[model samples]
Target: MKPLDEQQAAARSWFESLRDRICAAFEGIEREAGSDAGFAYTPWDRVDPSGEPGGGGVRGVMKGKVFEKVGVNVSTVGGTFEGEFAKSIHGAGDDPRFFATGISLVAHMANPHVPAVHMNTRFLCTTKRWFGGGADLNPPIPYDTDTADFHVTMQAACDAHDPAHYPRFKQWADDYFYIPHRQVHRGVGGIFYDHLSDDWARDFAFTRDVGEAFLRIYPALVRRRMGQAFDDADRARQLEWRGRYAEFNLVYDRGTLFGLKTGGNIDAILMSLPPLATWS
Candidate 1:
């Protein structure tokens, strides 16, 4: 078990704040759609005995709602790391001083018209240095307008900090979210960057402020489309898209890869999966 650095502490606080806002926003969405939506948060024990070394975030589930088949989770899991993917991505130095912490989130929406979304942010530190986390989206459906709006919201957040950020990072999302074998992107893409070296402090401040942007943008998008109504055909397409989502995560997502490599608890890592998934 190890103690958190200043950046990790800030990231943890941001993740917690996002967790609360996410729960409330979706609850309101379900209500507005005239559907029942509720979530349960289960706190899990940290991996290390000291409790400071690691811990799981809130796990939530919502079912039989007007616009969601199952809204299974929104969470932040933080801890130190090791193993193949972590070593490959974050580097494996002999120094035990390096510590990693991050938050990951995913939501499954009911309406075929709406897209599923995910966001993650974190900070990793060694005695001498640290870096930041950026977020991205994976929508199930391909609504051009919705996709544009989603990216635009993300871009706006980045633009406020640095104009150059929106384009480069958006392109990063576009590239990062793709399923290479399938030859299709996960969604329109938001933004994904990690271990940033340039303007690290600016990136952190930007990351923290963007949390509010997420709280504002995502629910508005969901509310607009969740109850818009879709036919059986649309529902089928949604399922098909979700199948791809599952494949990408199970097959290629970096987070999933690291979790498995670290001997992380299976349930916590797979908690990102939708409860009532369908494949065709």
Candidate 2:
């Protein structure tokens, strides 16, 4: 494997730091709930199609009283995009070589009222360099207050960077997260933006703000509803909703496809899956 450039090293460092903070926050929540659960971290390596070293990542997961299952992963990978896949990635058609570093997180709460959530932010470099990712809330039993808060926090993050960003990215998330066949959305929409290569410094700052916004808001939301009472019917509804989430990740998620195409670690790539889900 080649040594990381300055930008790549900085991004990888920030991502790993974010992962540590998030895991600590979650463990604190577990302690509050009278459970001592903590995240278990597993490091995995990747091998490119050429059988050369490709960078890898650590997968951190925890199952606890509040958070039924949650995975926080940080990876820094560099390799060539495989055949047809090269044509599909931005800026990679002509030069398939690429470098990517990012953090991805998904949490499915034990209590149905406590929403499940997904958040990811990444910096990728091919012929073009860009940053992309977003966060969304998924609840089987939706709440107006929770939805409003989540959107407002995300909007603030966007507004700090560019006033135009909130509306544009929010709609992008709405359109991107939809399950076309089911005619339903995976979750209440957040902001999703891609191919943001205009200015590297500005774009990277915005990406960092997105991560900070999620760190501030999501834990508060979790603590708010984690103690709420839920019944079997509620659990059933959560499971059914998770089925739709699964479908979208398996079929429509670009991140999933990128991981597979890049020869990323299978278990780390799939850490987004809920610990348990039901189709019906």
Candidate 3:
């Protein structure tokens, strides 16, 4: 693989910086809860048959008094897409070469009232380049205020770029996150956008704003409800909800499929799964 160009390097750097900020905020939450816990980062590399250097990522996770389990990962990788998958990627029709950088996060709170959430933002290039990612809330016990706050933040981010972006992506999230087999939506919707085209500079700006929106809004919600009391019934609900989350991620999520297809580290790819989940 060739060296990363300026755009790709910048995207990767920003993602790493975002990961650091998010981990710091979550650790601060743990500190407020009087837990000594903080994130532990493990680095991993990708395998490419051509002996090309396919860049790697760091998997950062924290288990603490407030956050039950959270994984925040950032990676920048360059390589060729394999066989059938090549046809499906944007610019890989003839040339399967690709470069991608992004951050992905999934958080499951210790308290059921404190919602679980997922956020990811990525920049990918093949023959063409574009940005993609969004965040969503998954509360076993929903709060109207929390849902509204989440959407409000995301909407503001989108509207700043294109007025149509918020409604369009919010609906995209509503559609994309659905579990058709289970006949249910994943959670209270946030926003999901992919292939945000036009130009790299503008698309990157919007992507940064989306990350900022999540970084600002989600920790606030977590702090608000992390101390709430819950009983066994609530615990049971959270577990059952985790079951749904696990199902969607393993079966329907595009990111999960992408990671697996690209020979990503198995443990980091599977880190989105809840620490504990129950079905039926």
Candidate 4:
């Protein structure tokens, strides 16, 4: 693996900082809900089969009155991709060496009305370097207002970079996040993008704005709906929808596949799974 350079170091620092800010925001919400729950971090390391230091990261999780369960993971791993996997990854064909740094989050709300969400942004250094990630909202009972607010914030982030970003990425999210077995869209999608290349500076700036947009909007959405009342029916719907979420992540989510393939921590890789979900 190539020695970590200044760019990789800078990206890794930003990811960790984002993780801290997000965890603090969530802990604050927990406090507001009268629960003392705060994120408990567990650090893990990865070693190549050759026993070389591959890199490592920390997993942060919190369970509380408002956030039933949430996981924020930051990992920077470097190693050669295994035999067949090298053919599939960017920049690994010539030499299987690679490095990746990113922040991933999954929040499952206790209140059904407060939609569950997923967000992740990453920079991967293979023979190629690029940025990828976006956020999506999964509501048991969809609300026009909430969906609109989420998309509007996402659009502003895209518009800040390029006029074409929102429309392109919005369609990309709808297409990428679809569940073929169930033949349904995963959620009222936000945006999902990947393989964004052409310029590192511009792409990195856009990726940072994407995270900023999520931080700015998601908590406000949580505060608005967390207080809303929900009955048994709503709870059941949330569970059933969560089943769909689990199926999609296990079957189709690229991030899940990437994590598992890269020898990432199993718990952190599967952290997107809701604590409790129903098939029916």
Candidate 5:
């Protein structure tokens, strides 16, 4: 790939920094629970179709008393999108060359009461450059207070940028996260936005705020519910719910598809899958 431009470099730097801070925070939670669990990082390189050196990323995963399974990954890659896949991406239909950098995370807690969560934010450049991503909460056993708090925090981030952002992106998330075959919503909705190519500084600021909001609200929610008591029945339900999450990611998640199309590391791409899950 070619050298990154100013905006691309900045976005990549911020994403790696966010990853470090988040890993530290999660390790702190483990210590609070008297477990020494910490993230294990693995780096992988990407090869484009032309056998050129595309950028790579590190995948960090942790399994502990508090977090049953969690994966945080940051990757920056550039290459020529192959065949018809290029047509679907924004600004890539004609040129087919693209660059992207982002951070993605998914956490599944040991306690059923503590919600599972997913968050991702990315910047992509083709003929056009833009930002996209969001966070959503998925609790096997739902709680109103937790749901409300999550939405409120995300809304504050959106409102800081544009008042219209929250409702619009919230609806986008609601729609995007649905499992059409199952006819059920994946989880309590958050915000999802894409193709935000208006003002570089403004969009970048908003994207960073989204990451900050996730870092702020999710760990608190984890602490709130991670100590609650759960029975075998609750564990069963959590497992069943994880089945749905798996289905959505495997069948409907655009990020998953993007990773496959772009020659991303298979293990890193599939890290979002729960450690355990059961259908029905």
Candidate 6:
């Protein structure tokens, strides 16, 4: 298969792997929470009516009754990266070709106690250029222990790839996951970068390793915490905090900006938005 085709296949396979991993992770979380948190899985596929040739996301969501306060959503989108990609992203110079092949993944956690997470890996291309996707995290509620634990796990994964990677990538995540005007942070921020120019072996290794680490670490974290039993007041407070998170994504998140700019399908782009969300 050609490089693009190969990348496409890899992305598809990765999506399935991610979905399965997250499902298992949440299942463990539900067990720990001592409740059967049901999952909402939607495999959506649609062709653009605008004659654009691609659309929609295959998505999965989970919410436990015991942990009814917590949930996780995962999805993948394959379509033309036109208006949305062009307008919303930064650090990428003006170029129409960045929309060449559209494939991206984003995952969100509903519990404020469990950090709300975001990861996106895509295959971007132009007539003369190409690069694989990258992943990052955005946690709305920052707990030093969880935040530190999260970064520590990721750092270990990156360190296994390159010792220097942890500090730099962790800083990158901090910088990338931010709402500049608010002067607060989007969670504590985790490693984020675009079009890194480095040895492919090392970069690919780091990305792949981090992916595995996510599978290894997050599910257990969620299982341990999700259904621990928060009061309605706690859930209410979480929803209030989620409202802030929603504002950042809708108003300032680069991904949301890019998705909207590229003329992405509204539903697909907005899938990143929680089904029901509020702000304080």
RMSD list, candidates in order: 3.1, 0.8, 0.7, 1.0, 0.5, 4.2
The local distance difference test score of model 6 is 0.56
Using lDDT as the yardstick, the better of models 5 and 6 is 5
- Best of the candidates, lDDT: 5
> Clashing residue pairs in candidate 3, if any?
none
Clashing pairs in 4: 91-127
Error of 4 at 275 (Å): 0.5
lDDT of 4 by residue, 190-249 (tens): 999988887988998999999999999999999999999999999999999999999999
lDDT of each: 0.66, 0.92, 0.93, 0.92, 0.97, 0.56
The superposed Cα distance between candidate 4 and the true structure at residue 200, in angstroms, equals: 1.2
| TM-score (C-alpha, index-matched) for candidate 3 | 0.99
TM values, all candidates: 0.85, 0.99, 0.99, 0.98, 0.99, 0.76
Per-residue lDDT over 199-249 for candidate 6, one digit per residue giving the tens place of the 0 to 100 score: 544555565666677766666555545545556776576676566667777
Where does candidate 4 stray beyond 4 Å? none
lDDT of 2 by residue, 128-224 (tens): 8999999988888899999999999999999998999999999999999999999999999889999998898899899999999999999999999
Measure candidate 6: CA RMSD.
Answer: 4.2
lDDT of 1 by residue, 1-280 (tens): 4456576667667667766776777777778767565776565544632245454455555554744533333333344455333346444454433445556667777777767787776665543344444555556657788877877888888888889888888888788888998999877788887776556577677877666677777778777777677888887777778778888889888777766654455665786676555766
Clashes in model 2: which pairs?
none
lDDT of 2: 0.92
Which is better, 2 or 5, measured by lDDT?
A: 5
RMSD of 1: 3.1
Give the residue spans of candidate 6 off by over 4 A: 1-4, 31-34, 46-52, 66-112, 128-142, 197-201, 227-229, 263-265, 275-280
